[model samples]
Target: MKAMRFTPPGYGGRRRDPDEVKRDGWRKQGLLAVSLDDQRLTWPERELVRQLGERLYGARLDKTEDKR
Candidate 1:
């Protein structure tokens, strides 16, 4: 997957790649992860990250749902 590039607020005054951010975020939240730091993230930003993670990883489905 192509990594996303974004500059976190006051993040060493530099941009960070999505892979690094996602990895760190995942480590923080485990299998179900999102932003790098939840406390630092605004509600919309957190939601965006959550949606992104869902799109990338695919949200879990119930037994009645199709896997495909």
Candidate 2:
């Protein structure tokens, strides 16, 4: 019997030579890359995306604001 060790997300036992995160996802899971507007994301995931977007870009547009 072997005990499983839990590692943090980025520091886990992943390949070092080449990053397998996106490649494996594209190959195995048939899932594309990250999308902030993906409907499959949960509320927390959406919030994280929103925060990251605002952090990188400017603040999000208000819903009440009209786009010309």
Best by lDDT: 2
lDDT of 1: 0.72
Clashes of each: 0, 0
Q: Which numbered prediction scores highest in TM-score against the true structure?
A: 2
Single out the weakest 10-residue window by summed lDDT for candidate 1.
29-38
Deviation in Å, model 2, residue 18 alpha carbon: 29
In candidate 1, list every pair of residues with a backbone clash.
none
Q: Could you tell me how far off, in angstroms, the CA of residue 61 lies in candidate 1 after the best superposition?
A: 8.5
lDDT of 1 by residue, 10-61 (tens): 6667677877777877788775444436787898888788688778877757
Error of 2 at 1 (Å): 78
**Every candidate's CA RMSD:** 14.2, 13.5
Q: Each candidate's lDDT (Cα)? A: 0.72, 0.73
State residue 25's C-alpha deviation in candidate 2, in Å. Answer: 14
For each candidate in turn, the TM-score is 0.35, 0.39
